[model samples]
Target: MAPTTERASIFDPDALERVRRELRLHPQQLRVVRNAYFKTFASEQETLALFPAPERVHLDPLPLHQRLDSTLDGASKLLFRTSSGLLTEAVVLRPRSGRSSLCVSSQVGCAAACRFCATGTMGIARGLSVPEVLGQVVAAGQLLAREQRRLRNVVFMGMGEPFHNEANVSEAVARLIDPSYFNLSPGKVMVSSVGVTDGMLRFGERFPRVGLALSLHSVRPDVREQLIPLAKRYPLDELRKTVRELNVMQGRPVMLEYLMLAGLTDTDEDLRALLAWTDGLDVHVNLIPYNPIDAAPELVGSSPEVCRVFAAALKEHGRKTTVRRSLGRDIEAACGQLVKAHTLSERRAPRSDTSSA
Candidate 1:
């Protein structure tokens, strides 16, 4: 547990207000500090310099446990240590377009237990507090700002099923788009889930402008259940309706995320079922190439050619589709992969450093 008198997170306005009153500082001073750190992503000293008695007003921060940059691509993975000693991750994707994006985790480990995900294998842990989630954006944004690049997008697609940790993730996202904080457009942030129906619907209603991505790895009920064990509870039929409802609520195409696993999810029937399920909903189908994880060696990614054919089929059926390019292949690019390997090696390095990757 944290100290009894824990500092307010830099993102927590209420806590900051209390701190300001206690310090007997002007309201504008608080604003300046917020704008400096949250908006500008300034260094610790630079931000603290703008405040009076900076040491007294504690801005809860997450430690940078480690940094992993992929040699093959513009991808960087950041591992942060929670006060609890458990590690969580955030990944930064820098495309050539110069608009960089950050992928933040909502939980330390995942409860959904998707068979293909490494985080799931670890079972459920505590949901990340708003600070932990937003710290990733602040830190990643600072990293990008130094490179003279803009942090254009933030996606909750890192370590866990987002909807499983809905409350904290929701608060973190609100501050991200709030002008007083990160000041990002709601459109630039995305929340991806493995079909947590109630939480998914609640998110759509709360943040209509923010994009939602459903990890529909398979449309077939049996296959989905096998791949995402949570499917057994939520079921595929309910998920389809939820997507349609999300469309009506948001007035935008919900993003359908499909991971292409060779024989498991990339077959003629799978394509047909997907087309059938999304026949009327407003959704952009994103076919993703699988990243191999040691936890699930049985799950082989579909070939590039097979993925292309799948995309072509979706387009032929008049569905909006894009084959998401795999970024950060060299540095255990999959979420939780680096941390899992590092944790095992700590007990079992020869550290598996990604700089040389």
Candidate 2:
């Protein structure tokens, strides 16, 4: 026989207020001029009425990890695990004062297998559910509120290949952008892909206004393939074509992410290739220094001189480029490094006695 399921209540004042603020609800609608308690109750009901689909309903942030921890009598920590084979576990990082952003996964372990990436070495796991994907954001919000923070953005550059899980990613974006729920402007969100053409095209068609970023580490096909295995299937030429189409469809510039690696993809030749590839396109280059990973001990970040030269070359080609200074590196929160420590620790852990006995 199938297990019985309980219907869960969706009312949450904090989640409702955060949703209201994010959606920019009118003051008159939020005003409580009548019976204070009744007015508050009516406001919440009206908010619920705004979203007919339960999935579209934005509730107070309740992360699965926190709920699990509390319910299990502090027996275990519920880490945010992705369906994407790229990562074994994750923690939803909630910012303290800015708009809320969900750090979403695209793969379990990345098949791109970039030497400098800890997640890349882990191999692909599977894509997360549309609900699970959005759940990370909800969890972040709930945790952030406890720390007096809110979620405002969503990044697909967490642990997986968003393009590999295009369908679910699209669905999550649709639900997030729905006016009845989170109602976030398309411009505020970004979908980062490691140069997946089909997924990029599909995303453009489905949500033309949502922001897009290509995890283009190098313009040279060989270098790209070495860093991102997807490059083998969708080479630079094809990727550029898809990017151009996306720009034309959105009528705005797309973000191009360039991860600078020392003695690897930061050479003058590489800069020239990058410029040539992006020639006459509506796009912005975000130059990111490679985050060191123990998995690939030889991989090192580009020197300041090399990074500056690369950025200068892009500018000389009449392209807009900016250096993305590393944030959260002190806390091991930099790109591609988040999953490394956890993965290493897990591999070293002894097998549970229950399994052996």
Candidate 3:
């Protein structure tokens, strides 16, 4: 009895090329398969049919375990079961603007421990591989294709802190925008970080056209440290400097994600501090309405009126700002509301004897 060999991911260039050589297939056949799976979001059976040796290549590295669609909005949360049996999540957002987006995770769980994020509650499991990260986009794209929509944007705002898994995430981004692969425009991909200065700089240098967003929920050092434990290592000044550098490198505005937490981040002082910090720096401030997470009971989102006023004040100061529309709240797929329930649900289930793949 011989041990079974694992299948190679279809997205892996080296593996796919090796398979192509071994099968003596033409390069065009491989190109067709790749384009079908990536560009057209074709089904696995459909994609594999285009190739002579179906078993030689595998389409999905992380299989879809379950999918939850929002009854309230056009948000679908796809829960993928990793080889270790841990469930990671990706969200497909179909905004009314007609440009669909998929939010992918970099790690199974977050290590940053942001108090306002549900993913931060479950301790870090491990960083997801390049295939695991890209698989999320593939699965979501296929789903959206079924509905006659093409995914236009890929956002790293799901379960994990992307910068913590910078190496794998950057490689995944490289494949995502490669013309031979997903073929997404560099501007369509955005990586959000909790102010990891070094990773942000490296990412900007590598993918100069790709967007970089800083999760600067608060400029106050004490408040930021309280919200994100990682903030202690990278102080507010360092983060501000990093954003300025990224703006220069990318030749575009760095997105500033400011979570509107009631009494915490929505105060007038917070707005003033944000204005001063962002002064002379090219940035587009995206004011996020915090979705309530059970892990952090003390935090609450700012009211709509307050959010409106905050956006107005930023506009008055000649700053670009927008209040991000809250989506997927019903299915727990909104901002800061992913992966916590999945961990809790898995814990309550009975233990199984099945071994991890």
lDDT of 3 by residue, 188-287 (tens): 9999999889999999999999999999999989999999999999998888888888888999999999999999999999989999999999999999
| Candidate 2 segments whose C-alpha is farther than 4 A from its true place | 1-100, 335-340, 343-357
Rank by TM-score, highest first. 3, 1, 2
List the pairs of residues colliding in candidate 3. none
lDDT of each prediction vs. the true structure?
0.86, 0.63, 0.86
Task: State model 2's lDDT.
Answer: 0.63
Model 3's lDDT to the true fold? Answer: 0.86
Worst 10 residues of 3 by lDDT: 348-357
- TM-score winner between candidates 2 and 3: 3
Model 1 alpha-carbon drift over 4 Å, by segment: 1-8, 346-357
Better of 2 and 3 by lDDT: 3
RMSD of each: 3.6, 9.2, 3.2
TM-score for each candidate, following the candidate numbering = 0.93, 0.73, 0.94
**What would the TM-score be for candidate 1 when compared with the true structure?**
0.93
Tens-place lDDT digits, model 1, residues 1-357: 222333555666777777777666899998899898888888888998898867656666678878888998889998887766677888999998878999899988888888888888875467988888988888898888888888999998898888777889999999999998889999999999888989999999999999999999998988999998889999888999999999999999999999999998999988898999999989999999999888888999999999999999999999999999889889766768777666656545443433221
lDDT of 2 by residue, 253-320 (tens): 88999988986788878877887888888999999987777777777889888889889878887899
